[model samples]
Target: MRAVRLSVVTAAATAAALAAVTGCTEKSDASGGDDRVVKVTATDSKCEVSKTKFPAGHIQIDVENKGSKVTEVYLLFPDDRIVTERENIGPGTKQKVTAEVKEGDYRIACKPGMKGKGIRQDVTATGSGKVAKRDPRLDAAVASYREYAQEQADETLPKAKVFAQAVKDGDIEAAKKAYADSRIGWERTEPVAESFGDIDPKVDLREDGLEEGQDLEKDWTGWHRLERSLWQDKKLTDRDSELADQLITDLTDWQKRVGKAEITPTSMANGAKELLDEVATGKVTGEEERYSHTDLVDFKANVEGAEKSYELLKPVASENDAALTKELDTQFAALNTLLDKYREDKTSYVFTSYDKVGKADRKELSDAVNALAEPLSKLAAAVVK
Candidate 1:
């Protein structure tokens, strides 16, 4: 009887110990597990998100496009600053974007057409790290650039109005002049301007993106479309005037929207290099202004835009590495000098005379742009360091 009692007591004590160990294992697993995954589906006009609450840390989202339209999923802050994004998701497909976020509120916006104010879903993240502190210098630089964008935006409105009025009145020569002149402001701020939903594409998309079976008579608009009417078709129709009015309205809206934009040093440097690339790919090849042959005007304007971006970030880059800054300055000056030879005046360049330019001259100009682009590429890294 004594042996039986002892055996039963021992068995009960072992069972209790095992239960305590199991409870601790469960607690540890809960504390250090995988990040919460959010599933999202995008349709024509709506965004459906699986989860609206998360624990702050590294989060992953699998965005499936269940719609007919091409879409982009963006994780934006309250101010519309993109935290991370997955772009160019085609129909019947899926892509993913992962970001390490602190405890705060975030917005998940899905742009179906890749243009327009998209459907947004709000999420609340709970964690120890909340709203990470930003570098003051970087913040100041972004603010300065935002102010510059506003100035450019204000500059574009009146000029764009004049250009539209010329098209409305059927004054071809005046309209052409205004078109080239007005584009300067738009080109200067193109990088930031492009973030403003549907308006940017309407204001500046190239002809290569036109839909299948879509043509001038069916679904073309904006600067390139007008460029075709004025130069290729040789007549600015009533439709052209209507499109012009729409462009003006869009630009006004863009001006307001850009006020909420966020800028970073990396983006600014990348914008500079991107403008040079535009010169190389389109302007140099004469593909951009196929109808008007106004490639030189755009080339000059692209250089101006690139120069502005480079100048804005030059201080930070120079502090990091003066040698790189010096090299970039020299390369930029060389490119500018080449562009100056084609200028007709302070605000204009001879777009028609591009055909007359010899092969050697074009090669020299192209080489100078390429030279600038190389050193300019490193500026972004320097600014980050």
Candidate 2:
């Protein structure tokens, strides 16, 4: 695990899956050439967004982290609905995000160290905004994605229970087998799971990701903690058994709350990119499932999630930007094909452990993820166009 990690999430808005959000079309002043581009300067303690008041359409957030620690920038609706966000902006690096917005009041938040409620700024999208003429296919994509999210949430609770029961029974080998199996749905729909803000940290947080003020012995709990007790410590504690029940309880909450999540087409496209980002930052590096070395399982799930998002929006994207769609198709196929090489168990969702992967193979996997992510980044722009 990296000592300094900035790649985490805090929800902006509701606690569920896909949002059919309200957005503005073209309501900003045409005379203000390029003024819609928001330049965000981030520091360890402060975040500044240039031209907080701008016209709304396809707005671009250009972020440069000048802080000593890694930070993140967000564009949020007044209700805390996430319009779009770019996380893991390491100190001294820059990242850009393009999102669709309606003319409305929004908040610009910067979280330095990726911790707590961030510095906030009020921004307004000025105009008598009209509903942008969006493709019907995009709307259809949103609907289909919502169904998919619900399906994952529905399937997860049962699998998680089996894993939890095994743990409670002190069935080490069964628990280990059921462990990675239980997380496939979660890793597949993580962006939706993360929309609830605190849920991800509660269920999936690794020890290395504990809050600065949290005590490891007391504050840290999740799949990773359980994995440590099972595989690393090689013994189960009473606390670990209790944690197993809590895991199911938390996921049960997630299952019931899935439909409550907000969904938008741009959010889906951006979520696809975020899934790839998770792979690059965590799973690809083998930090996510360190104790169990089941990183490949999560890695494949992340890729599948990203691919699902891309596939849903492909029809609209093909019409608006066929070239991008083609490249995405190629890259996605290549990545999946590459990942298939590691599947030793055809009967189940098992793969070679991440720890068993070599440096060259890992680099190859990283390259494949980046290759797909590049085209995936342009998806929101294409669909919104």
Candidate 3:
């Protein structure tokens, strides 16, 4: 539960370094002329819309939250893939989202309180519109993120191997350090890792998912399980190293799959939003890394991944809306400053002693993360526009 001091020098240097690395332009918020705007009214538990059918193309939904609680609306594919989503729309505030859809059945989800399953309505697009031309800028952006995803996966394998070896050699101190180092690359490419069947769960599943009747002895597997052994129990046995071996094996396969993985502009944006959500929901609460208390590592990695996603799409997004790009860049720098406060070394942040950390310090980080999430959530629709 050690706390690392935030030096004024580090903060100034990080801000100065990243400011030059990412560039942005200035622009205004403009609506597309081709958008078929639909009016959507969201209540506490229901979503009412003007129509459920449209021609296949880009359609805009002007959503007004008239409920007591905050609400979010999502356009989802039949396979449950989210097309586009808007979050943190407070009561009485109107938010607009434009989704590029094809001829198919989809679900319109309006989530009240911004959690759990929302009320759903089936929406269909029948007639085919003229094929929209692909933007070369967005295509290049997708290619960039795809390459980054591969780089992250490749970076993870050797670290996993080192972690496994440390555990096998029964060096608890070395294993503890290796454990945090191992998670960085995984956290960066977590969304893509999730696409590789059950490998993600098998490699990174937390102990909280233990079945109704199962205990740690039964279902607890992957990184957290090993974490509990090393930090809580303060021991690494032969059985623990066996789990580490399996982790390396799984990641090796994931690396190959990531190389062939299909990454589009939509996926990149969704991945960025999801990464921030990971911090807000799990890491901020200290539920993730419950044993090691190294949630900062995951938080920093999530921000890194999200920023990389924005960087990939910046080319096209900046072309259409530079204001949003500039806002995101500023927010990212702010969040990075907040995270760098706990720098343990060149590549790691010391674990936050959750029990020892003050409420004000915790809230400061949480507020900074939410601030960044506000701009990140709009990245997809912004780029697509």
Candidate 4:
């Protein structure tokens, strides 16, 4: 697999200059003097040209953001001089930038959102000019995505180990509290739950917590019982030794799962889509409001999922079916852009008054997320086909 690089959108001044020079064509009365126009569209970290050929002299770049995020487009010269930069073209929107060129070989680099991969194309300055195929944004996005995942994984493991040790050391009360707190990390990683499926059933305490002949609550609340046991000094008796051993076994299994698992792009995309759907349906309930941490955790999970999806899909973009690839590219870009706003809004909550963020704020967030559904659905449909 090709190594992915972290994507940080470089300033216009930092990009390469156009190198290839071409002869000017005689102006014809029928068409406007040899001015060439190129339309560059970015979707799912890939760039495509509506037309391959145009006249060279003054060039106009029309950028269409068909993806789910904002994107940056750059026209570069051979000398690494940036001809022009068009930044923050929002989802489903379009923007134009013009540059005068003597013509030669120039590169067009488009990055979908600040953190996304970049798409690059090499164009030749000919009689007019022709758009060539190149994709650097995809590489950038994938690289950034992998980098983000690795960081999260690194942070999560040591914390999990600390909590696990607390449990083994008979610091039951501390272990219970840590377990509850740890849910924030685990829930963000629900898609990877299978990796931790070996959680020791003995530690679950679900069966022992039940009252004689009583029915279990629909919600998974066994953690609460474990909490009580820790504080109440209700140590397992000799007869319960078998269950304790089983619990230890389960925890060990969970550790292995966490160590070996790799998160896939498809899973991240699908999971985010589902969570967003729930939010749209208002199924998230008051728990989301009361437990602000839940919202924060969910937001992080969604971001991670979006990042991973871009990473996985970007590398395969060129090989995908044309229409499908184009559609996915567009959606991925839009989603990445939208996530930036979502992250900002979420961060502001730390200082902003939550009570003031009422219905309008929630609606705005929902609308931003809903904007992602169409493109994502199209991408999903294409994958199945």
Instruction: Give candidate 2's TM-score.
Output: 0.87
Clashes of each: 0, 14, 0, 37
- Model 1, 92: alpha-carbon shift in Å? 27
Candidate 1 Cα deviation (angstroms), residue 62: 20
| Model 3 lDDT per residue over 194-294, tens place | 34444565667676544345556654567888888899999988788788787788788778767565466766776577567657755687887788888
RMSD of 3: 9.4
lDDT agreement with native, every candidate = 0.66, 0.75, 0.68, 0.45
Model 3 bad stretches (over 4 Å): 1-54, 59-98, 105-124, 168-170, 191-198, 209-220, 236-242, 345-356
What digit string (tens of lDDT, one per residue) describes model 1 on residues 1-385? 0001110111111100000000101112112244466788999978998889877754567788999998878776665545555555789987655445667788898888766547999987777533324347766776777787788889989998998999899988888888877776777775444344455556675676554455645555677788887877878888999989988987887687667654555556655665675566446877666777777777776777677777877777799889999999899888887787777665555554577777788788888888987787667656655
Which candidate leads the pack in TM-score? Answer: 2
lDDT of 3 at 221: 61
lDDT of 1 at 345: 65
Which residue segments of model 1 deviate by more than 4 Å?
Answer: 1-134, 213-218, 345-352
- The lDDT leader among the candidates is 2
